[model samples]
Target: MTAAEAARQVAKHPIQARNPIQVLGRSALSAVRMVGGVGVFAVRGTIAALSPPWFFNQLLRQFVAIGFFSLPVVGLTAIFTGAALALNIYTGGGRFNAEQVMPQIVALGITRELGPVLAALMLAGRVSAAIAAEIGAMRATEQIDAMRTLSTDPFRYLVGPRLLAGVLMLPLLTVVADTIGVSGGWLVATRVLDFSSAVYIRNTVDFLQGWDILSGLIKAAVFGFIVALMGCYHGYNAKGGARGVGRATTHAVVSSAILIFASDYLLTTFFTHAAK
Candidate 1:
């Protein structure tokens, strides 16, 4: 082939080949950029939360929305999860003739893993989506712009309260979830599994350590922050009017759920090593 033709053929071949290495490199860069953007957003949010002109009214309203309104769903999820856990544990332990260990295992599992994770997942679905939808709608409608025109910082007025409330309230909700979950396990153990109520309670109480509960609370706090952060980030950056708001709502929930699980694994690993 002539030099010009050979050059054009080489260019076409590269385009057609679709190099795996190049594809992977592009994906990795995109992921890094996304993570960096999220980090910057988180820093700005934290600064806004700490600055003056605190809005206690907004914070109180968020408390009711994130903590109180979330109670029924969180509680229901915890109870059913605990019941299923108990039944499963009983069945598995029965194979080894160790069914008596159900109470202790149930308590440990709930407090250390299930309680905070389940509660946070529920909040991500309910509270995170709500926050994103609200803020995204405000963005789509230009209400955020109007607030800025009125000399109001949207971060301070909008993002700060939800962040504070989520960080503070989720641990409390997780506490309630832990209680309800343990109670459910107890109910199943005593009623369905035919375990003695008093002995089961005693085993659970005796086996559950302070660190187990504390670790779960710590996880809850982190998950809470993640939920709020994801919601605010998506909502604040949303565009495309109504469609943008809808997309933000969905992203908030999905990202919060994914981050919750990811962070839970990290925290669990940290706690495990620390205990060791």
Candidate 2:
């Protein structure tokens, strides 16, 4: 028997038979119900987004809060990542006396992969948790019900703005990250590693293909969408009290991170093939 079966048997009522079949059937039904509920919500959200009557103010707030507030953290990560990438490349390439490739490699890696991926993960943790907690708390306090009672559509006010914020802010944040990352590599190559700054920058420019940068930015937008969607989805559905809110927060981060990595691979494939 599975561990779940054994646990069920142990918790079985004294007068009832320990029926694993019933347990399995109930569990299967629960799974199906959950899947159906998710489909409903996804459809509902999509339809709502397509509707012409929208909440512009809330959308603007989401953009400013998520994109503007996220700048400092994203910038810091990119700068450090760029510097460290340069050092690592210099060390590895020096084995073949090819340390000159640091600038181009760092630039490519940061813009095409690390910048968007890392920024999304970071924002996932920060933004997702905050959204889940705030929404969950409001839910626990019955504010959602209050909105419904007032004839307000919660999805348009809450989910739409957040979704728009993520889509918009992510690309902007990526630009900042990309620029900062290249500058970081410049610093390391010129001052710390004693390479000529002009040579590094020029080579980086010459080696860069448009697709490399474009692919990463596209991934950022997708990642941002996933992160915000998961956050709002989990938050809107959050159950119970404080404990449920915590669980929703955890699920948002975990789900968003997985989707980001998965989307990155697909985006990479598209860019690679297009370039060919």
Lowest lDDT block of 10, candidate 2: 9-18
How many clashes show up in model 2? 0
Q: Write the per-residue lDDT of candidate 2 for residues 1-276, one digit (tens) a residue.
A: 996785465446423534777666556765687668766766676566657568888877788789988989999999999999999999999999989888989989998999999889889989987887778887888999999888888877787778778877898899899999989989988999998877988999999988778888888988888888888888889999999999989988998898899999988888788878
TM-score of each: 0.91, 0.87
Collision count for each candidate, in order: 0, 0
Give the Cα lDDT of each candidate: 0.91, 0.84
Give candidate 1's whole-model lDDT.
0.91
Task: Judge candidate 1 at residue 109 and give its lDDT.
Answer: 93
Q: lDDT of model 1 at residue 235?
A: 94
Please list all clashing residue pairs in model 1, or write none if there are none: none
